[model samples]
Target: MKVAALDLGSNSFLCLIVEGDKSGIKKVLSDQVKVVRLGQGVDKTGSFHPDALKRAKECLTEFKKEIDRHNVDRILAMATSAARDAKNGSELFKIGEDIGIPIEIIPGSDEARITFAGSTEGNLKGDENVIVIDVGGGSTEFIVGNRSKLHFAKSLDVGCVRMTEKFITAQPLSESEKQAVENSVDIALDSILSEVQKYPATDVLAVAGTPSAIAAAEIGKFDAEKVHGFILDQGKLQKWCDILASTSVQEKIEKYKIESGRADVLFVGATILHRFLLKMNKPAMKVSIKGVRYGVALEVLRR
Candidate 1:
């Protein structure tokens, strides 16, 4: 069967189409991503912004066209943190229905589980203890597991979009603003550190935009093949944070080639990952291009 998985995240909307059966995926038909910032003002306003909604609808329209061209046998669409938190988030489901796609708002725990499954797929070897970190736009998820079983999973309300809106207001963040962002990340991680410590992982695999963006910056280009399995150490993350903190958004876009929607929040996002890595006592993390969408596709095949 050919299956399509749509991930409506706080910062981006992604679609993955694959030809697969119960054994495994045979071929990847198409993969598309658009930074829609669907959680634009939801952190503060508690509702979806009109402009964000418009962008989401337009992006989904495009995704629908792509799905049609592929002639997918099944499509499973799920919305993450943004839709889960927004007061008017249900409207997103209505939009999906209108577009002939049904969108389900999944809880954070479920998000963590699927993220672990996807990020580790094709990567994990026998009995490897791995921790999968998904630093999203509205929330960050941590999952500790081996190749066969999941041990722990938690999603915290500390993400690029959320932290950026909450702490970073000025371009080239002031010392105090930077401190504030770091402090908040530390506090958020404080709640989960003990639990995470109980399940020590041999390797840390980071997924989603923040790690991908950082990997792209490190490689000087956005190539999935290179980005995947990339190693990002604490020193490198701190260096990128410093570079992003000093540069203007335009410079990040033109020089660093960061996505327009992600440039502003990139610093905070990297900081969150940095703090998480420090807390985990790991020097570096391996990047994974696969994420929730891949897991969703796998789930659809199972059903």
Candidate 2:
């Protein structure tokens, strides 16, 4: 079957089209993304802004055109974070329906499982105990497992956009603001600590944009082969977190070559990623370009 899987993320819309079967994927037809920022101001507003809805409409409509070109057998799309938080999420759903791409709002718990499924494929080794961290714009998913066995999975209400919206007011945040960002991540981690303790991970795999940007900055460019499977050291994560947090967003783009909209919340995202590594006491993490979209694509193949 030919499949198109959509990840309707808070900060971006990603689509993965693949040719695959019940056994596995064979060819990747196309992988595309657009920064729609669907969750813009959603953390405080609890509703979709008119511009956000317009962006969603434009994004999904364009995605449908792309999907049509593929002649796919199935199209699976899931809306996360912002959609779940917004009161008028249905407005975006209406756009999806009108555009011929229906949307399903998935809970964070499922996001964790799907994230794990995506990150682990071709990355795991012989029943290795692992943790998959998926940091998004509005939420972060912490998942622990051994091979295919999911030990613990939880989603925290801490993310780059959410943290930035809640506490940060300046480009170079004050010391207190940095601490506040850290505290938010820590508080969320603490809530799931007991459950996390039940399953200790041997390897850490981080997915999504935050880790991708960090890897690109460290590598001096956004090369997929260089970034994917890159082992990001613990100290380096902390180092980048502090450095990025001390600079303005434009500076991040100019210095790190970060994508424009992504630069704004990267520091907070770095903080979330680093703190989790520290909490787990892992020395380094492997970065994967595959995330929830990949997992959803796999699901379409099997279904």
Candidate 3:
């Protein structure tokens, strides 16, 4: 069967088409990433901006045509943090309905499970302890499990875009700002950390853009073969944070190749990643390219 998976995320909207098989699946058509910032200023307002909603609706409308062209067996579309918390979340759903694609809002635990499924396909050992973290635009999912079972799973309300809008003010932010964001990440992880210790995993699997960007940066400067699942050292991450904090937004855009829109929040994202590693006591983490989209594709295979 062919399936179309739409991920309505806080930072970006993604549509993936896949062909299901007994072994796994194959990507057929995957195109277009509309960075609509759907969760714009959601941290302060507790709701999605009206403009963000309209832009998201517009993007989904165009995606529907592509889905039809692919002639997929079914459409499995889901919304993440923003849609789950926004005051007008229902309104966004209604807009999706208007476009003929009904969106499913997934809870954090479920999100964590799906992310685990995607990450462990080739990386996890049958008996090893592993933690899979998905850093989305609006929330981050942390799951501890192995090949056979999920010991712990949770979702935190900390994400790159959310942190950017909330804690970052200046282009690169000051030293105090970096410390403030780090402290906030520690505070945010407190409740989740209490649960994480109960299931203590050995290997940490980091997912989503922030980790991916760090991996890319490492690869761009180093060797790609030595890069995948590379342990992100706290010292390196801290250095990046300090550098980002000291630089201007334009500097980040030019130096790091970060999207102009995302440059403002890159420091927060980088800081959050580093702090998470410190709290987990894991030295190195494997970066996974597969994440929610792969999970969405896997859902079709299971069906």
Candidate 4:
């Protein structure tokens, strides 16, 4: 069956159509993403903004058209942090109904599980401890497991969009502001580090926007084939993190060709992953393009 999985992230929304069966994804049919900022202002307001809702309606309408083009057999659409936190998150249900694709708001723990499944789909060794770190717009899910069995899964409220909205104010962040962001992340991570480190992950996998943008910057361009399965060196990752903290948003766009929405929160997102590594004492993480949407598709197809 050809299934389409939609990840309605706080920072962006995506639709991925693929042909797959019980074993695993067999072939990719289409993949599309748009940085819609659905979580815009939700951190402070605790509700969806009018402008963000409008953008979501428009973006989802377009995605529906794309889904129709492929004649997908099923659509597994769902929302994350933004929708989960918003008081008017039910708005997504109406929008989904209007688009003829119902959407579900999944819990953070579930996000971690699916991300682990999707990111490590074919890469897992039955006995090796694996940790899949998925940094979305409003939250970051740290999932530690082995052989598809989850041992520790926690979602922290430290994400690119959430952090930038709450802490970042200017381009080329001031030292004080940079420290503030890291400090907050460290504090949140402190709660999970003890339990996460107990697993001693042999493979650390990173999914979602931050890693994708970083991989693109590392390769000097956006090439999916090159970005997927990309590995990060601790030194190089920290170097880029420093460079981003001291750089302007436009420079990121001009140099790496990332979308504006992503450019705004790229540094914060990278910092989350950086702090995760530091806190866990992990050297590096392998990047995976497959994330929530991929996991959603896998579940739908396998069913």
Candidate 5:
């Protein structure tokens, strides 16, 4: 079967077309992503901005063209954090229906599970203790498991876009603002820290845009193959965070090749990753190109 999987995330909209069977995926037909900032201002306003909605609709419309081109046997679309938290999130569902694709808003726990399945597939050894972290636009999902069994999963409401809107106001964030964001992250991870201690992960795998973007920056390119399995250490993360903090959004985009929409919030994302590693006591994280879209594809194929 040919399947189309769509992830309508808070910061970006992604689609993947794959040829697969009940056993496993065979080949990726197409994969695309657009940064639309669907959760813009939702942290403070409790609703998606009108422009954000419009952009999301536009991106979905474009994605539909790709899906049609592939003649997919099934289309599975899911929305995360932003849509689940926004008071006016139903608007996304309406748009999805208009586009002939009904969107399902998944809970955080489910999101963590799917993320773990996707990020670790073909990468794990079935016995190594691993934790998969997805730093999304509106939330961060933590999944702790070994190769065959999931042990712990939790989703925290501290994400790049949410943190930026909530605490960062200056173009170059002031030290005090940075400190405030750090404090907020610490508070959010308090429960996660204790729970993670119980699991004691041997390896950390990071998925989603934040980690992917950081890997791309480190390698100085946007190639998914290169980014995947890329190991980012604390020192490299700190260096990149400092660079992102000192520069303007456009500068980051132009110089570091960060996605234009992600440039502004990249610093916050880096900070979250840095703090997450510190809390987890992991020296480095391996980046995964696969994320929710890949997970959805696997689910549809099996079904």
Candidate 6:
């Protein structure tokens, strides 16, 4: 089965095409993400900006073309924190309908569960207690449990794009500014920290844009073969944070060859991951390159 999954994210719009067979699945095609920053300022405004909406619609128009070219068996286009929380979400949906693509505004809880399912189902290896963490554009979702059952799940408003726009104003942020960002994460985490601590978990799995991009940067530095499901220690993650914090976004883009748009949010995302691991009292987390789109494909397969 060849399927297409479009993730309408706050930071980037991703379109994934995969070939699912009896043995396993393989990536067929991936659309280049246009950093529309759809959730830009949504944390404060409670609605999508007019410019962001135009950009999102333009990206979706491109994705719809690709879906048609591939003749995909199923097309699952889901929106996350930004579109889900926006006051004008219906307008966004109507825009999608106009483009002949129906959008699914998945709740944060469902996003967390689907992310966890993809992390576990795709990897086919991990401890019984796997803590799935997805550091997304607008929010972060945490889920801890085994394949059969999810023990705990929650979403936090600590996303890279959101945090960067909100707290990290200065380039290579000042010490005080950095502290402020950490404080914000701590405050937002307070409600879930207690509940997350109650769960008896071991292995930590991180799945989402931030973790994957961070792993890619680290791998580029080390010339690693593959970063999928790579076990990353807190020390290593801290090292990444230090490096990204020190380097200018241009330097990062030139050095790592990362997309210019991604360079800005990398540091903010790293800080969020570092703070999250510290709060969970976990030493390391395994990265999952696969995320919600893969889970959506799995759902299609099951059906």
Best by TM-score: 1
Q: For candidate 2, what is the lDDT?
A: 0.86
Q: In candidate 6, what residue range of length 10 has the lowest lDDT sum?
A: 220-229
Residue-level error in angstroms, candidate 5, position 191: 2.0
- Candidate 6 differs from the real structure by a C-alpha RMSD in angstroms, to one decimal, of 2.7
| Clash tally, candidates in order | 0, 0, 2, 0, 0, 0
- Clash pairs, candidate 6, are none
Error of 5 at 164 (Å): 0.3
- The 0-to-1 C-alpha lDDT of every candidate, in the order given, reads 0.89, 0.86, 0.77, 0.87, 0.87, 0.77
Give one digit per residue, the lDDT tens place, for model 1 in 1-303. Answer: 999998899998999999998776778899899999999989899999999999989999999999999998998899988898899987888889999888887665576667877788798888968988888899988889987788888888898999899988887889999999999999989998898888777888989888999999889999999999999999999898899888889999999999898999999889988888888888999999999998888878887
Worst 10 residues of 2 by lDDT: 105-114
Residues 1-303 of candidate 6: C-alpha lDDT, one tens digit per residue: 887767777888877777786444566566445677898788888999999989888988988888888888877778888887889889889888999877887765576666776667655455467777878888888777876777888888888888888877766768887788878988877778887777777777787677777888877742224767677888988998888877788888888766677888888788877887888888888887667777666655555
TM-score for each predicted model, relative to the true structure: 0.97, 0.96, 0.89, 0.96, 0.97, 0.89
Q: Name the best candidate (by lDDT).
A: 1
Model 4: per-residue Cα lDDT at residue 112: 69
- lDDT (Cα, tens digit) per residue for candidate 5, span 1-303: 999999888898999999999887899999999999999999889999999999998999999999999898899899989988899988889999999877887665577677787788788885878988888899888888976788898888898999898888876778898889888988888877888889777788888899899999888988988998999988888898889888888889898898888999989889888988887777998899898898888888887
- Order of candidates by TM-score, top first? 1, 5, 4, 2, 3, 6
| Model 5 CA lDDT for position 124 | 82
Error of 5 at 117 (Å): 0.8
Task: Report residue 291 deviation for candidate 4 (angstroms).
Answer: 0.7
C-alpha positional error of residue 89 in candidate 3 after TM-score superposition, expressed in Å: 1.3
Off by over 4 Å in 4: none
Task: Report the candidate with higher TM-score, 1 versus 6.
Answer: 1
Worst 10 residues of 1 by lDDT: 105-114
